[model samples]
Target: MSRWRTALVTGASSGIGREIARQAAARGVDVVAVARREDELRTLAREVRDTWGRTVEVLPADLLTAGGLAAVEARLADPDRPVDLLVNNAGFGSLGWFHELPIDREDRQIRLNVLAVTRLASAALAAMVPRGRGGVLNVSSVSGFQPMPTNAVYGASKAFVTSLSQALHEEVRGAGVHVTALCPGFTRTEFQAVAGSDVRSLPPWVWMTSAAVARAGLDAVTRNRAVCVPGAGYRAVATVVDLAPRDVVRRLTALATRASLPAPEAGR
Candidate 1:
């Protein structure tokens, strides 16, 4: 049985977020599914309700907007409803040279990945700390383990998430509130398509399914683990990244990223 009575999961329209909602419901937790797409959220709500007989509330909101963020924050702070879990899973990435990429998109990425995650976490913790029984699972990425040359902004944002989660975990553990960072490696999801990350060259062994990632994250938070790196391969990679010297890791990451990209045209 799940420790949580109710969970609010963002980015619930698809991928890991969607799987987390389904799996949490299966584990007997009621869910509030949030996403920009109402149709998708409603569809997930129906599926979860039909499959597990759990209450699934569909909340449609874009976290980037002030009105959307306010709506979700208000829901998190609602004492009557009282969300027992907060899953900060709504994020996206852009793969390219930082200088060449659109500045507005990068700013938006920070707002969604960093600003929104921080705001929602604050709202949830404000309520949960007083109650002394709740959890927060922030969905981060393995790329945060090191400096990603091509995907700089995304990496930095996830690094912030991991750091913030660990700090929050230490702060609220005594209060019986769990805070965990779910750092997943490459997973088969719409994330790659949305981010324009071509992972066709990456081996199948490096990838994990969304369901497995979701299961590991939910289990980690339930057990009050501070950090959960889903796959063995990713865990190993994260360890190496952690141990390596900063400069060496940065140089190697740049080289690896360059090697993965197509060569520039012979003539500019």
Candidate 2:
């Protein structure tokens, strides 16, 4: 197994982020796990240390905050010792009518999903470019390929991620910095729980394991693939969505969004 040496992963407390950290550690990569939940981050750090016997450092920061993002930026800019890999996976979705959603929640989603991703990717590149060897894997979604009615903001953020990943890959090709965007479809993760959606209600085929998705994503990064949509089923769906008429796709997505919305509380 090739060691990553030093790797930093945002949103490392759980789900795909957690799986990425564990897999990297298992292969002898020293991991810095970043997330808002200190307790969960610490717990996962311990698990990595015990399970993989690799060094695991936890950095608890809400990437949406200026102070937190600044702190992360400082860590990534350290030239004396640079990280060899970066995994941008800190993001979430709001499953509801767009107008009914709270303004602050919408802002948080964009801040963590888009702004933080762009900033961190830049910082990682600043360090990696000088050293001339590293990888950046941005975790996007199949939603990025189409209009998502209920997950509108989230989907837009991921589309930004995918676009940025492709652009960066071309720009940094000769500089030894490989960039990849991982477009996954409904992986088994705490993402739905955080988004307040019932994952179990979705069809079994729609759910992929976080480990499996992470493996595919990391492989793409190592191989320097510009974009990766892991499963055959997901790739097929993405192809159809890519080719479908825009207006028709939007209407169907809006109907599905309506079905996913929660009923108003009894007192309200």
Task: Put down candidate 1 lDDT per residue, 145-179, tens digits, no spaces.
Answer: 88898899999999999999999999996898999
Q: Write the per-residue lDDT of candidate 2 for residues 1-268, one digit (tens) a residue.
A: 7536888999999899999999888888989999999999999989988998998888899898899999888898988767889999989998876777898999999988899999999999988988899999999999898778878888888999999999999999999889999999988888888898866667788788999998898888989999999899999887888899988888987777667666544433
Which one is best on TM-score? 1
Off by over 4 Å in 2: 262-268
Off by over 4 Å in 1: 263-268
- Candidate 2 Cα lDDT to native: 0.88
C-alpha lDDT (0 to 100) for residue 22 of candidate 1? 96
Instruction: Score every model by TM-score.
Output: 0.97, 0.93
How far residue 152's Cα lies from its native spot in candidate 2, in Å, is 1.1
TM-score of 1: 0.97
- Each model's lDDT comes to 0.94, 0.88
Best by lDDT: 1
